[model samples]
Target: MAAPLSTRPVTMVSPFVAGGTNDLLCRLLAENMGKSLGTTFVVDNRAGANGNIGTAFVAKQPPDGQTLLMGNSATHGTNPTLYPNQPFDALKDFAPVCMVAAVPVVLAVSTELGINSVADLIAYAKKNPGKLAFGSSGIGGSGHLCGEIFKTATKLDMVHVPYKGDVPAIQEVMGGQLALAFVGVGPATVGIKSGKVKALAVASSRRASTLPDVHTVEEAGYKGVEVTQWYGLFARSGSPKDMLDRMSAAAKEALAKEEVREKMLTQSIEPTYLPADELNVFYRNEIKRFREVIQRLNIKVT
Candidate 1:
């Protein structure tokens, strides 16, 4: 068994704001990993520019294993295409720690929309005619990507509206500020349960545990629209191999705990762990797929 990487507390940078799934998982792992590794872990929230601000901040940190980043599908997957001058290279600036969890994306609408299912939403959009608008966290965030995927799959010409984070988007949906939002299950859970907003379909292969009654994209008859927002741990590149291993080991330990797993599941976040090397491969593959999708969909920055 490897020892904890540092004598000092570790800082895990979450590249989004506080109420979203990324921040939620970041705090969860920080607390549990600290316990398992015998060191304190601090969570730093760096939000803005669709996760580029905090991601760039982490990329500049010292590679001593004391500073880790909680990266996700937005930073690693869609950012390259979304930000032409993004400061850090998602693949090159960080050493893979492990993949932490994946959350389904929900196409949720305000009850005011009178859209009860994916099919109804489509017909409503068609009837509305002049560019039905949709909301997301930001341009490159997972919600934005999921919206693009859903739009392409359904062949709907809709406008994209970017919010600061998932909570804001969901809030807008509940307030009827926007027609709907494609958001992660975690941040949308509260509104979904409150009945202020209702999910039309989950944009993943499986239904979300937090919203078990919601049908999946495939179940709603749109298989190509299935996508999940994945989160993972990463350290500044060139961190000591042993330190990286220790961090990976500690994160794995945290994820293996039953309490942590249950908390994540209840939030509609699925705990999916992958070792460092495997996670690196997964990140690269996801990045490639994202690049292809962005091009295929002509997803240009606004």
Candidate 2:
């Protein structure tokens, strides 16, 4: 792929500001990927709309392989159900380039609460009924959805507390005003390490290596409670076949590199690169899978 026509620089778009985990990961890979292809790789931050704004921006860009989108679950899988008029269709508006990585969402509770496990949390919710309040980053966010799923799976009654972002939600939880939250490992790792929060379980099929002592929701005897924070790459549908193939190969090779693998591991993110066609299969299946949850919960924007 690095022939005479490989002089064009690739532009990568991230939906969060600099210093965020997404931005950091993209920046880290840019160096290696850029060197591999003999071209400049730049990360553009287009933060807003909970990632929709940046995603839509990239979705509308030309399918020239130069402009690529670092698509997350929120922008690609969950936005359709969350926003009534999502400007871009995750499946229709873009071409799947590759999957970057997957992070685990950990369920944690304030130490003052005395809840040590998923069963204990359910028991406490049952005992208190609507008294227990849980905070999330925002309505329809992954944290909120995780709580909703938990309530439905356990058949418990708990109040939903939506916050502006994870910062305030985590503050309230630490202050003992909010009992629990399913927080991203990026921010929650520090607190978990400092003993500020007690981790109940990870919301994935397997336990995270970062918290080997903690069990997964599935291991807690709860059926059908798997979740992951997945991130991937995409370009507008009709991107050049050769360019897409070349980029996909480069991405997979980068993931195999020790530096990329180590950086992802530091954030508790497991790097797994998927080819373009396989990513499309995943995107379609995720849409269908989440729709059932949204419908079952009667979740809507209005």
Candidate 3:
């Protein structure tokens, strides 16, 4: 049995702006976990610096489990390599509490382009050469990484445009400002359903439930181009093991609810709950994996 959690109200810090994937997941988890744990979990949006500002804030908090962070791929995975001079160390400054969800990136294009599939996109890019441009939520974001992976695998010359968020990037694609965008299915699902944008491929090994008709990149013959962005919980380093264990239990319990599962699926997130120890391994592997990919690709942010 797990020990008692802090009686104080817990705050789940979201390092990104409201209305984003992280924010949505944070609110969802906060509400569900609050009910399961019988404690208040408030979502605090502290957006800026590509998630560093808020993450740095949380890193300095006390080692008690009262304050939690909703960390995602950018803050914990690619940022370590892309922004090496951050005030907080991704690994040393915080401890993994639990992994909440995983979202597959999608290839969204403007419906005006008449492109129907990944093959069509490749052929168009080949004909246009450097004329094509793709947008992402930001540089080093999962969307950008997926675009880079796709470009490298297919040997295409599509320029990258960074946007403030996926919605804006998809808006650009809808307006034909960008040929396509590699974005999370959560934000892209609405546009795809409305005919404002079309999804050519899901950048995962398997098809996304949100867009089951869209084939995976591997299915489109671009094997090994699989990419995903995951969201998880974190607390300051050196937090008590029992506290972490109780927190993990509450999270897993909330995740086990079928209503929660359905809601998460509707948002294009897979309810992937991992305990603290397992999340530690998962987080470390992600950082290491992304580091290798960033270094080999010679990706830099200036």
Candidate 4:
């Protein structure tokens, strides 16, 4: 039998930079899980290389269940395909804990562009061709893929401008420097509510609860453009099964809290928990799906 985990405080690594949605979600979940586990769960921001640095760090750590990773779609799903020589294998290096939540990607346009809906934007792009420009957090990010999917499905020609991060990309769109952007629901919610940007359509099968008035891409006559960024918890692969189960159960209990649900909803993240067994399958599928998307779009970091 595997040895019991140490009583030391668990360290949950957030690969993305601080103040982003990933960090916020990690902290929120860690705080609640800490309470349930009777141990302090601390978030350590190890942001770099589009989350590769932190994720790889966790992969190398001993599987005592004390070192955890707060992984997102980009870290565990898209990066493997985006980076040809990834330092670590997402599927092989980690043990699934539980899925935290999924947030929809929203296509937001500058209000000054006078584009009120996805149809309007598509029509404009078709007319202007390569003149319409869209920005993303990076070349191979979920937002970037959403833009590429939009381009493919709509048969529109638009230029892609890659930014260092989503905040700058969304800001440029709001400033009318770019035609539009595919942003995560959290930032998109704030932008929409502030009237700084107008959401054309959300790239999910169903409309987001935070933005109920916005139409989905399919509802707007554009099918097969769905992209949702999901977050999950993980531990090193060699961790004890019992320890993994305990952590997964704690995660589920934390997610089940009314306050936690409200907080996630307030941040435009839909709380949907999947246990370890189901999440492992979901994680593998996400990796495969993103790999196909990257191959189809010829997306690569280097």
The C-alpha lDDT values of all candidates are 0.85, 0.80, 0.87, 0.85
Which candidate model has the greater TM-score, 1 or 4?
4
lDDT of 1 by residue, 1-302 (tens): 54655689889898888977788898888888887777899999999887889999999998887888888887887887778697788888999999989888889888987889989989988888755888987776678888888887898878899998788999988888888899888668878777889888888877877778889989988777867788999989999888778778877888889999998898778988899999999889888878888888677777
What is residue 128's positional error in candidate 2, in angstroms?
A: 1.3
State candidate 2's TM-score.
Answer: 0.92
lDDT of 1 at 51: 81
Tell me the RMSD of model 4 versus the true structure.
2.8
Worst lDDT run of 10 residues, candidate 4, spans 1-10
Question: What's the lDDT for residue 88 in model 1?
Answer: 84
Best by lDDT: 3
Q: Please give, for residues 35-55, the per-residue lDDT of candidate 4 as tens digits.
A: 777778889999998889999
- Which residue pairs show collisions in model 3? none
Order of all candidates by TM-score, from best down to worst? 2, 4, 3, 1
Model 4 stretches astray by more than 4 angstroms: 1-6
Task: Please name the candidate that would achieve the greatest TM-score relative to the true structure.
Answer: 2
Encode model 3's per-residue lDDT on 18-63: one tens digit a residue: 9877898888888887776778889999998888999999999999
